[model samples]
Target: GCLPISIIGLLVETTHLSLVTPVGWWLLVYSTVVQFCIAYVSWFAALARLPASVAAIGTMAVPVIGVVASAIALGEPLGAGQIAALVFTLAAVVLATR
Candidate 1:
């Protein structure tokens, strides 16, 4: 709610554009908005039901997944630092979960 409004407000202020999305970009933006809403709702429900420690540990994979997904989907290079960070993150999650 507030997140989308704040983002829209910022876009409006910076670009001085109307509340209209471009014709071709509307579907793409709509899809992204749907995905964000779904993820936000699911995350809220998960946090409500789960322990904070467990939720925090679960989110540790978010960055690792983001890096890997970007590399695969965007042809981005996976640097050694990213690989190391991912390994360390996985190790920490494994250890914490145990």
Candidate 2:
């Protein structure tokens, strides 16, 4: 998903590569290893063990959690439309689980 964008970014910003500090490089490596590799492996392992319906519910909740987390952590707004969507998503998950 990120490959094309990453390639384009690298190509365009090649000249500015020297601006990345050691900390930035370390963070990049850490995030790539932990978030991409470890997280995906753990998620797939969980998926393999979980029932399909349960996994589906968990997958559906990801966006809801992201939105709510962004609101709380990043001070992102949760206006009426977002609130309504959240409500509907939760309602659907509840209905599906039953």
Against the true structure, what is every candidate's RMSD? 4.6, 2.3
Question: How big is the positional error of residue 57 in model 2, measured in Å on the Cα after superposition?
Answer: 1.5
Give lDDT tens digits, candidate 1, residues 1-98. Answer: 78999998887776534655697477767688988898889888889999877887758889888989999999999989889989999998998887
lDDT for model 1: 0.84
Tell me the deviation in Å of residue 82 in model 2.
1.2
Q: Report the Cα lDDT for residue 61, model 1.
A: 80
Residue-wise C-alpha lDDT for candidate 2, range 52-85, written one tens digit per residue: 7887887779889999999999999999999999
Residue pairs with backbone overlap in model 1: none
List the global CA lDDT of all models.
0.84, 0.89
In model 1, the runs with Cα more than 4 Å from the true position are: 1-32, 48-53
Best by TM-score: 2
Query: TM-score for each prediction?
Result: 0.61, 0.77
Stretches of candidate 2 exceeding 4 Å from the true structure: 9-15
